[model samples]
Target chain A: MAHSGINLIFEGQNLPRLLGGLWITIRVALIAIIAGGVLGIFLGVLRTFKNRFLRFILRLYLEFFRIVPTVVLLFLFYYILPKSMNLNLPAAEVATLVFTLWMAAEASDIVRGALISVPQHQVDSGLAIGLNRSQLYYYVLIPQSLKLMLPAMMNLISRIIKTTSLLLLISVLDVINVGQQIIEANQKQYPQGAFWVYGVIFVLYFLICYPFSLLAKKLQKD
Target chain B: MSWQIIQQSLPMFQKGFILTLQMSALGILGAIILGLMCSLCQYFKIPVLKQIVGAYIELSRNTPLLIQLFFIYYGLPGIGLKLSAYTCGIIGLIFLGGSYMAEGFSGGFDGIPNSQIESGKAIGLSQGQLTRYVVFPQGFALSIPALAANIIFLIKETSIFTVIAIPELTNTALDLIGLYYHTNEYLLVLVVGYAIILIPLSIILTWLERRIRYGTFGD
Candidate 1:
C-alpha cells in the first residue's frame, strides 16, 4: 500500500470534497425536476389536444425520447450537438437538457393519463354549467388531475435524481464521478478503494430516493 | 463515408451485439426465476424468507443500476468473490430486474380476487396445490402486460453495462468513437444501432400483450 489505508479516502480533505460533489448532484436534480415538471405539463397538455396532427407530433416526440437511452442522449448533447451547432455548452447544462427532455416525455404521459382518468361525468357536469374550456380545465380538470399526478410525478423526480449519475459519463463531476476520481487517484495506495467510494455513492442515492418513494406510496394509498 | 472502415469495424460491432443479446437473455431468464421465487415466497407468507426477499427488493429497486453494477463488479472482488465483467453485469441486471419484476408479479397476484383462492380451498386443495392449479395460472395470465413492459424495461436498462466495460452495443460505439475521434458519426451509429434492436423489440412486446389479452394462443 503506497498511501494510507481505506480510512484516508474518508479523512480530512476527501470527506468535504465528496460532500461538495453530492451537493452538486442534489442541485442538478432539483433544477432538472423543476424545469422538467413545467415542460412536462406543457407537453402533457399538447399530447391530449383534440387535433390529430398535434397528437401525432406529441406521440412521435414522446416515443423518440422514451426509446432512446439517456446515456446516448447525454452523449449526443454533450459531445456531438455542440460541435455540430457551434455552441459550447457546459456539461451540467447538457445534463439538464437531456434530463429535461427525458422528464418531459415521461411526465407528459403521466399527465395525459391523469387527465384522461378524470371521469367523463365531471367534464360533462362542468360543460352542463356555463364553464368555458379554459374554466373547465382550470377549475375542474386540473385540480382533480393534480391529485392523481402528484404521486407519479414524485416518482419521476426521484428517477431524475438517480439518472443524474449518468452525467458522469459526460465527464460531469457529480458524486459518482467525483468518487471514481478519488478512487483512481488513490488506487495505488488502496487497491480496493472503489468499494468505499462507490459504496458511499450508493448510500447517497438511497438516501435521496427512498424517502420520496415512501411519500409516493403514502400518497397513492391516500 | 468509408465502406472500408465500416467493413473492418463490422466484426467488432457484431461481437458486441451478440454479447449484448446473450447478457440480456441470461439476465432476463435470471430475473424471471428470481422474481417468480420471490413472489411465491411473499405470496405464501413464508416466515423469515418473505422479509428477506422484501428487503432485497426494496434495496435493489431504490438504487440506480449503475451503482449496483459498480458494487458487484468492484465490491465483490474485494471480498474474494471474483466475477468476470460479463458475469458481474448479468448478476447486477438479474438483481435489479428481479426486484422490478417481483413487484409487477405481486401486483398481478394481488389483482386476483381472494374468492378465487377461497373457492380453491373449499375444494379441499392443499395450499401448494391451490397455488399451482388456481392462483399461478390466473396470476401469470393477468400479469402478461406488466411482464412485457418489464422485459422492455430490462432491455433498455441493459445499456448501463457499457460503463463496466462489458463491450455491449453502447460500449462498442464508445470504443469506435474513441478510436476514430475525427469521425463525428458516432451518435448516428449509436442511434441506428439501438433503434434497430429496440424498435422491433417494442413492437414484439406490444403484439404479445395484445395476443395475451385476446386469450389466443398462437395458431
Candidate 2:
C-alpha cells in the first residue's frame, strides 16, 4: 500500500483542512437549525390559523418543500437563483439557505403536530382564566408544545446535521468534501485512500449525530 | 428556457426515469426485507444477533447516507469488494432504507402485546408460525403509516445516487444541463420527473395507510 492508516489524514495541513471543514459543517447545521426553528415555529403557528388563505398558502409552502429533494433545491438555489435573479451569494450561503428551507418546512410539521397535540382543555382553561393570546401561548400552549416537540425536534436537528452532508454535492467543502479532497490529493499516492478517508468521515458524522438521537430517545421515554 | 430542447429530451428523461423507479422499487423491497429481519431479531431478542442488528441499524441511522454510499462504493473497493455504481447505489439505499424500515417495523413489533404471542404458543404454534401469523400481520398492520413514510423517504433519497454518476434521473438532468446550458429546462424536467414518481407514490402510500388503519385496525 502506498499509504497506511491515518497517515493521509494527519499529513501536513490535511487534518486541519478536514477539521476546518467539520467546523463549517457544524456551523452551517447550527445556523440552519436555529433560523429554521424560529421561522418554523412562526409558520407552524400560522398553519393553525383559522383564515383560509393563510392556511392554504402555508400548506403550499410546506408541501413544496416536502416534495422537492434537497439536492434539487441545492442545485436550483446554488445555480439558477444566482444566474437568473443575480443573488450573488456564495455557494455555502446558498446551501445554507436551501437547508434552512428544508429544516423550516420539516420543523413546521413537527411543531404543528406537537402544538395540535396539546389537549383542548389546556387552552380552554387558559382562556377561562382570561389569559390573553400572548399570555395563553406563553403560559399554557407553548410550554406543553415544547415538551412534546423536544424529542422530535432533537431528532430533527440531528437529521438536519446529517442532511448537511449533501453539501458535498454542492462542493461546500464539508467533511465529506474534505475527505474527497484528501482522496483526490492522494489518489495516486494511495490507491485505497478512500477507505481511511471515508472511515474517518463516518466517525465524525456518527459522533455528531448519534448522541443527539440518543438524547432524543432518552428524553422521549422520560 | 429551451422548451424545444426539453421536448426532444423526453426520451432520455424516460430512460433515466424508469431506472430511478427500478432502483427505488428494488431498493425499497430489499430494505423492507432486511428491516423485517432486524425487527424480528429484536423482537425475539436473539442472542448476539440482536445487539449486532441493533447496532447496525443505529449506526446506519446515525451516519449520513452519503458517507455510507461512499463507504460501500469507494471504500469497499479497497477490500476488493468492488460493485457497479448502480449496484452500489441500490445497496446503499437498501441498507439506509432498511435502518429506517427497521425502526418503523420495531415500533409496531414492540407494540404487539405479549399476550398475542403467548396465545400463539398456547395454540401449539412454533416460533416461526407465531412470527408469521401472530406477529408479522399485526405488526405490519400497525406499521403501515411509518412504513409508508419510509417508502416516501426512500424514494426521495434515490436522488442521492447522482453523486456516484448513476445515470438516474438527477444525473441525467445534470448531464443534460451541462450539454444544453438550459438550466431552467433541465431543472424543470428533473423536478417533474421526481414529482411523477413521488407524488403518485405518496398519494398511493397515504391511501394504503388509511386503508390499513381502517380496514385492519378499525376505527
Candidate 3:
C-alpha cells in the first residue's frame, strides 16, 4: 500500500506541534548564540593573554571542545553528568548547557582569529596616542575586529541553528523530532512521510542558513 | 581518574576507536575521489555537468549532515531501498565531505595564476601533459592545508553516525556511560578517547600544512 496521502502526514494537530518545535528550535539557538558569544569573546581574549599558563589552559579548553563531537558532549551532559553529580535537570536545559559549551569554543576561535587579523600598526598608533592597554583594546582593537568578526559570527549562528537538530536525540522536541513524531503517528497512512518530513527539514534548515550565507557574502563584498 | 572503569571500558572503547578510524578512512577516500571528479568537472568547463556539480555542492554544503544521514537511512527505506546504518552514514559523509573538498580543490585551482597555464601551453605541452606535469602537482600541493582540514572535519563528522546506531567512538562512549552510570569517569573517558585520536591528527595536519608551505618535510 503506497501511503502517499499528504493529508495523513499533515494531520489536524501536527502543524501546531511542529510550529511549537520550531519555536523551541529558534529559542535554543538564540540563547546559545548569546550565551556562547559572550563566553567565547571572554575566552578568546583569555587565549591571547600574556600569561603563559592562562593561554595554555585556554588552549586545552579549546582543544577538548573542538575534538569531541557535540553528540557525545550532549550525552555526557544529559546522562553522565547527572549521575556523577547527582543533579537532575530538564532535557532542554541540558541541551542548552552542552550547546553553549560547544558554541563558546567555536566562537572563541572566531574571535581570536578576528582579533589577530587586525593590523598591529593600528594598535601601535593607538598606543602612540597615549591610550592605555585597555583603552587601545576597547577603543581601537574591538571596533575594527568586530567588523571582521560579524560575518564569521553570523556563519556560526547559522551553524548553531542547524546543529540544534541534534537536540532532538536528547528528547528535546525540536522540529526534526516533531517530524519523527508525525512520521510515526501517520506511518500507516503516510508511509512516505519520511521523505516529506525530512524534505521539510532540509527546507527549514536552508531557510535558516541561506540568509546568513548571503549576509556573509554581502559583508565580504562591503 | 579511576583505572577500574578504564580497564573495564578499554576493550569497548578500543573497538569503537577502530570502527571510527575505519569509517573516517572510507569517508575520506570517498570524499577525495568525489571531490576530485567534481573539481575536474568545473575546471574543464563541462557545461551541464559543471552546473549539476555546483548544485550538488550548494545543496550538500548548505544542509546539516544529520538530516542528510536521516534522509538516506530513513527516507530511502520508505521508498523500499534500505541501507545499513554504516552504509547510510558513509554515503552521507561522502556527500557532505565531497562538497567541502570541492571548495578546497577549487581554491587550489584558483590559486594558480593564469600565466602558469599559458606558459605550460607555450612550451608545446599537450593539455593533458601540461595538467599532469604542471597544474596538477602544484594545485595538489597548494591544497594540502585544505585537504588536511577537511580530513579532520570528516573525522569529527563521523560522530553523526551515532544517531543511526553506528558503533563508532561516540556511540561506544554513550553505551559505556549507560552501562556504568559513572558520569565523571565516563565523560573523562570520552574526552580522552577523542583527544588521543584527534590531537595527533591535528599535529600531523599542521605539520603537513607547514611542510607544504615551506616545501620541506621537517616539522
Per-model TM against the reference: 0.94, 0.95, 0.92
Candidate 2 ranges with C-alpha deviation above 4 Å: A1-3, B113-132, B214-219
lDDT of 1 by residue, A1-222 (tens): 445346856666787898888888788888878888889888887777799999998899899887888888888788776777888888988888888788888999999999999999999999999899888888998889999998999888887888887878888888887888788888777777887788877888888899998898899889
Docking class of 3: medium
How does model 1 score by TM-score?
0.94
What is the total number of backbone clashes in candidate 2? Answer: 0
Assess chain B of each prediction and give its TM-score: 0.89, 0.90, 0.94
Highest DockQ, which number? Answer: 2
- What lDDT score goes with residue B218 in model 2? 35
Top candidate on TM-score is 2
Q: What lDDT score goes with residue A221 in model 3?
A: 67
Better of 1 and 2 by lDDT: 2
Q: Candidate 1, residues B1-219: lDDT per residue as tens digits? A: 565676767788788778878888999999999998999899889999999999898788788999999988986676568889988999999999898889888888887878888889999999789989978877887787888878877877788899889888789888898988634565666677778888999898888777665232342
- Sorted by lDDT, highest first, which candidate order results? 2, 3, 1
The best-first sequence of candidates by DockQ reads 2, 3, 1
In candidate 2 chain B, what residue range of length 10 has the lowest lDDT sum? B210-219
> Which candidate, 2 or 3, has the higher lDDT?
2
Each prediction's DockQ against the real complex = 0.63, 0.81, 0.64
DockQ of predicted candidate 2: 0.81
